[model samples]
Target chain A: MPTYLTQHQNRFLEELLDWLRIPSVSADPKFHGDVLRAADFIKDRLLEAGATLVELCPTAGNPIVYGEYMAGPDRPTVLVYGHYDVQPADPYELWTSPPFEPVIKNEKIYARGACDDKGQVYMHVKALEMMLRDGGLGAPCNIKFMFEGEEEIGSDNLGIFVKANKEKLQADVILISDTGILANDVPSIEVGLRGLSYHEVEVTGPNRDLHSGLYGGAVMNPINALCDMISSLHDENRHITIPGFYDNVADLGPAERAELAQAPFSAEAFTQSIGLPAAVGEAGYTTPERTSIRPTLDVNGIWGGYTGEGAKTVIASKAYAKISMR
Target chain B: MPTYLTQHQNRFLEELLDWLRIPSVSADPKFHGDVLRAADFIKDRLLEAGATLVELCPTAGNPIVYGEYMAGPDRPTVLVYGHYDVQPADPYELWTSPPFEPVIKNEKIYARGACDDKGQVYMHVKALEMMLRDGGLGAPCNIKFMFEGEEEIGSDNLGIFVKANKEKLQADVILISDTGILANDVPSIEVGLRGLSYHEVEVTGPNRDLHSGLYGGAVMNPINALCDMISSLHDENRHITIPGFYDNVADLGPAERAELAQAPFSAEAFTQSIGLPAAVGEAGYTTPERTSIRPTLDVNGIWGGYTGEGAKTVIASKAYAKISMR
Candidate 1:
C-alpha cells in the first residue's frame, strides 16, 4: 500500500507555505532583506531536516545555503542543486492572487514560485526527511545541498563557488530538481540542453525626443528605425539573418531526429494546449525539431520614447529592446 | 507679428482637456466603446475647426476620422497625419495623475495625449481657427486632415487608406507633429526614419511545465536554454554574432560619422540622464553611431512559465519573447 499523508507531511507543507510567503526576489535589489530572510529560513529548514553543518554562504550578491547529510565516508556522494530566489512579479495585477501569498487553487498551488525551484527544492527536502525517518540514512549516495539565492538573477557566484570548492562539492553526478515534466500527468526526462544569448539595443536619432511637426520629414524616428532593424533579423522563413549564426550549429542525425520525433506530440493537441492558431516554427522543421534542435531569435522586451498614457506626438529620443537567442 | 497665444488659447486647451479624457486605447478590445467616443470627439473638433466635409471612415478595425479644409485649388495641398487613439496605459499606477485627466502641472499639460498627436493636432485646429478669424480664408496651403484611431496599434487601416486614396491624399509632403523636441528648451528637427521588424518566439522543450527535481539533469530548462541562447548573440565587445547581420549595412563616411559624433552629447550627461552606472554599446563607435546607423537587437519583452508571484521550480514547458529591431 502507498504511504498515506502523515502529520509530518502536513507540517512540512505548512512550512513550505510559510517560505512561499516571503518575497525573496533576487533580481530586484529592493528585496535584499527578504532574500536574506529566505536564506535564513532555508538554513533553519536544512537543520530541521537533520542536515549537519548548515551554513548561509555569503557572496557578492545573494547568499548560498549549503548543507550536508553524511552517512559514512564509504558511501558515494551526490550533490543536489537548486535556487531559492525568484524573478520579480511585475505587471503585478495580472496575478489572480498575491504573488507572495501561497494560495492553493484547483489542486495546483498558484504562486510565483510554486512550480519553480522553491516547490521542487522542497520536494527533495521532504524526500530526504522520509528517508531519514525510514532509516537514519539518505540514499546509497551521500547528499550535499547547494541552494543559491541568486539563480533567478543569474548564478553569478556559483561558478566561483564550484571552482573554489571542487573537493567539497565533489560527487559522482549532480542531482538537481530544478526542471519540470512534460505535463501534469505525464513524466518526462530531458536529454539535451540548449544554449542562450541575450542582448539590449538602443536606437537614437535626435539628441532628445523631437517635435514631429517641425522635423518629421528631416529627423529619423528611432522607433521606426529600430523596427526596421528588428524586422530584418529574420527572413520570411524565420531563419535568423545573422550571417554566421548557423555556422557553429550542430545538425541532428536522421536517426536521432526520428527518435526525438517519436516522442508523443500532436500538432492539434499542442495548438489547443497553448490556445494558439497553430504551431509556428522554422519553415522546414517539425515541431519537435524546431523547438529542441533548431536555433531561434526572439525579442524579449521593447520600449522607446513614450509608451505611456495617451499619445505623445513627440518622436521618441530613443528606442530600447532586449533580445534573446537559443 | 506672430499670432500666437491669446486668451482663447487657454480656453482651447480647456476644450482639449475635455476631449483627452476619453481613454481610447486600441490594443485592447475591451476599450471599444471608449475608442468610438474618442472618434466622435475628434469629428466634433474637426467640424468646429471649420472642416466642411467630416466623415468617420470605417474599416475592418478602428474607424478613421477624415476631414477636408480646402482653401482653394491653386493652393498647395498638405495632408496632416495624426491619431486619435492611445496606447494602453498599463503599469497604470506609475502615473502621478490619471492618464486622461489632463492635469496641467508647471506649464505642461499632464495627460496621455498631452504632447502626443492630440496636443499637436489641437495646435493645427487652433492655427486654422486663427487663420480663419483673421480673414485668411485662402490660406497658403489646402489642408486634408487624416486623423486615425489606430496609429497606437500600428495604423493597420491607415496603410490601406493611404494606398486606396493615393490621389485624394496626395500632397507636397506629409506634415506630422507626433514627435517631441530634443529638450524642453532646445529646438530640434528629425531627418531620418527607421524601419521596424517585430516578432515573437516561443521556445519549447518538454510538453508541459516540469518538476525540476525529477527532470533537471535530463531535460532542458527552456529558461536556462533561453538565457544561454540570448547570451551567445553578442561577443564580449557587444558586436552581434549573427554571421551576416551587417552585410547590407550602409556604413557612414568618416565626415558624416564625425559630424554625428560632434553633436552635443556627453557620456556623463547621458549616463546621468538615464540613471545608469555607465553607457555600454558597440565598440569603436560613438553613442550616436551605435543608436543610429548601426543595427542592433533587444528583447522587448520575455516571459515563460512561472513568472508569477512566488518561486515555481518549474522548468517551463515553453518560454516566449516579443522582439523589435531597427
Candidate 2:
C-alpha cells in the first residue's frame, strides 16, 4: 500500500546499510579486501543505475570507481566526487556495536563511515536511480562519478590518475557532498574550508632522562626549554612571534568585519559551553573574528618524560610539540 | 672452613631476601598486610641479631620497629636509623620481574628495595650479629635501632612517635645508612643532603577542550598560558625573577668558592654523560656550584591535553606543572 516514492526511499536506505557493512578502512592494510569489496560494490551499483562505461580504475594504491552518463549536446556536464573508504576504527573497544556490523539505533545508522561519505555518496546513486526509473525527470545535467578509495588516506593515487587522464575526467565543475553539516535542521552550507599548515617541533637537551636532584640547576630540561620556545611564539598582545608569518595573511576590511559580526552568536553561551571565566585573543578583535579571520599558532600537543605517579625527579631528554598554523 | 663473617654473610643475605619478598608498599592501601608483615619481620630479625626489647611500636599508620642494646658506663650512645619500607613499584611493567619477587641479575640484586634500606639496613643488622657473635669484639658504643615502616610514605607517624618518646629516643648522634655512595671503590661519605620544597601549580583558561580551528586564535590555551607564566620565572640572564626568592640565600666567600672548585671534575665528560652540548646555569657559576651551592627552580613534570597520536586540534582546559625549588 506504499507509494513508489516511499518504496524507492526504503530501497535507498537498505542499499546504504549494505555499503556501510564493509569495513573499507583504507588507512590499515587489514581492511584491504573490504576496501576492494566496497569499490566493486559502488561500480556495480552505478552500472545498475544506468551509468555507462562503469569501470574500477586500478592504481598503485586502492582502486578508483569511475562511471559516466552522457546526455544530449546542450546539457551541462557535472562531475561528482566521493570516496568509498573510512577512517580506522581504532580503540575498537570503545564502540558499543562492532564498527563493521551496521545497526540503526535511535534512528541513526551506527557504523564507521555512516555519515562521512559512504552514506552521503549512496544518496546520489539512489537519486539517479529514482529519476531513471520514474521516467518523468528531465535531464538537467550530464553526470560523471569519480569515487576513490584513498580519500581517508590522503587520496595519494587519485591525483596521479586525474593528472594522467585530465581530458577523460574533464567536466564543467566538480560537486562534493563530503563536508560536515551542523545538525539535521540548524545547518549552514559550507562554501570552503580553512587551509591547514602543520609543523612538528622537537627540542632535545640531555640525551636521556637525568635525575632532577643530581642535575637540576646545571641542566636545561627539554620540557622547560620547549615551554620557553612555545611561550615566545606569542608576544605580549598575543601576536604571533614568527618572522614574516603574516606576510601573506588576508586581512578583511572594517565594513566586511562588521557585516560578519551581524551573524548570530553569543559570547556568554560560548564561555559556558567550553567552561571559561571569559574569552581572550588578539587585542582588538572579537572571539569570532580571531577564530575565522585571523591566523593562529596553536600547540596541538606537547609531551616529555615522567608524567606519572607521585613524583619522579627527572629532567627529560627531549620534548615534542605538534603545532598548527591556520 | 669459612670465616664467621662468610657464614653470617650467607645467613644475612637469605634473611634479607625473605624480607624483600614482602610487598611493603605504603603508598597504596591494598599492600597494608605486606607492610605490617615487613615491620614484624624487621622486629624478629633485630631480636635474632641480639638486640634487646624488640617491639613493633604502633602509630596511626604503619608501626615503627624499635630495638636496643646496652653496654656498661662510659660507652657513647648511638642511634641507628633505617626503614624497612620501599617505594611503590609502579609502572610495574618496567620491572623485569615482579617487584616483590626478588632476583639477583647481572651481579645486581634487582628488586624494589635492593639499594634502598632493605639492603643497606640489612648490613647494619648483620654487623650487629657479627659483633655479638665474635665475643672478642669490644663495645665502643651503646646502640639503639629505630627502623620504621613509613619512609617511602612521608614519615608522618614517625615524627609523632619521635616527639612523644624524646627522652627514650635520646642518643649522642643518629647514624643513618640512607645517603648515596659515589661508586664501588671510590666511596665518599655524604655528610648532609639538600632540602627540597615542592609545589604544584595549576593554570586554567577554558572550561573544556575546544576545537582548535574554531577557537584557536580567540581562546587562550592553558598550555600556552602556563608556558608564558613559567618563562617569566627566570629573566634573560637566567636569574630567577621571583621577587625576594634569593633574598635569604647564603652567599659563599670567594676563597670558599675557589676551594670548592678545586675538586676533580671533567667538563667534557660531564656534558657527554648527560648528552648536552654544554651545561647551563646562572650567569657565573660552575656546574657543581650551580647544582649543590645555589638554589634552583625546575619543572619536574608538566602536562596538559592531546598528548597522543598524530594530531588532536584541541585547546586544553588546564595545564599543570610540578615545580621544585631546592
Candidate number achieving the greatest DockQ relative to the actual structure: 2
Docking quality class, candidate 1: incorrect
| Per-prediction TM-score to the true structure, in the order listed | 0.57, 0.80
Task: Report the lDDT tens digits of candidate 1 across residue range A1-326.
Answer: 11523747678788989988888888677788998998898889888777877888888778889988887899888888888887676546656789889888776777777766789888877776666665444456688999999776446788888888888888876887765455667677777655555566777666555433333323345655565576667665767789999999899889998898778766776556644456555677887677667877665445565433323344556666555566
What's model 2's lDDT at A179? Answer: 70
- lDDT for every model? 0.69, 0.78
Cα deviation at B175, candidate 1, in Å, is 18
Question: How good is the docking of model 1, as DockQ?
Answer: 0.06
TM-score, chain B, each candidate: 0.88, 0.83
Residue A67 of candidate 2: its Cα lDDT? 88
Which regions of candidate 2 are displaced past 4 Å?
A1-74, A80-139, A144-162, A177-187, A253-259, B10-44, B57-64, B72-74, B84-113, B134-139, B147-158, B181-186, B197-208, B240-259, B317-321
lDDT of 1 by residue, B1-326 (tens): 34444646767877899878988888677888999998898888888777878899898888888888888888888888888887666545557898988788778888877766688887877776666665444457788888888876556677898798888788877888875455656565556654444456667777655434333323344544554565566665667788887788888898988877666656676556544445566778766566667776554444555433223334466765544444
Worst 10 residues of 1 chain A by lDDT: A211-220
